[model samples]
Target: MTTQEVANRYIELEKQGRWDLIQEELYSDDIVSIEPDSAAAMGMAKTVKGIDAVKAKGKAFNEGVEEMHGGYCTEPIVGGNFFSVAMGMDVTMKGAGRMKMDEICVFEVKDGKIVKEEFFF
Candidate 1:
């Protein structure tokens, strides 16, 4: 798939809250996920290699979220083999209380599969 096609599929699955399916279908086995430098303070690694590790990171976050008040995912902006989305969520964390989290999610695609995803706040 081209970047635009991947972006569209990502948006569609995200709207359906099916990120797990997206990962399974659209990501490469060696996909990498990167968090901002400051995320280390939150117990997230600066970079995670492999699709399984990426899913584990997401699972950890989900486990820590007590409730989700709201969330939004913007239409993707396609650029060559890359795409970006502006996403945010309001949520209550297990021990951190309620917080509004906003960030830009950028994805890189190659050979019709997502190879990398990086988050910036």
Candidate 2:
């Protein structure tokens, strides 16, 4: 698959609420995930390495969400080996209450697999 193909499929699965499947299928084993400095204050690691680590992050995040009101990953803008999407969500956390979250997520793909994902809010 090409970079665009992978990105499009990612958006498709994301819209279907199938993020778990995306990481398993589209991400490289050594993929790196980067969270902003502010996220560390919320208990999220600033940098997460490996696919398993990424999955763990997702699990931890899900465990913190009491309810998901709604969420979305917008269409990606592809360029060379990268693509970017605007994503956001409205959710109530276990103890953090309800809040709206928004960010731009940029992904770097190589050999048809996503290798890095960085977020900017």
Candidate 1 lDDT over residue span 51-113, tens digit each? 889999999999999999999999999999999999999999999999999999999999999
Q: What ranges in model 2 sit over 4 Å off?
A: none
| Residue 66, candidate 1: C-alpha displacement in angstroms | 0.3
lDDT per model, in order?
Answer: 0.95, 0.95
120 in model 2: Cα distance from truth in Å?
A: 1.0
Clashes of each: 0, 0
**RMSD per model, one decimal:** 0.6, 0.6
Q: Residue 112 of model 1: what lDDT?
A: 95
Per-residue C-alpha lDDT of model 2 across residues 12-104, encoded as one tens digit per residue: 899899988999899999999999999998999999999999999999999999999998888999999999999999999998999999999
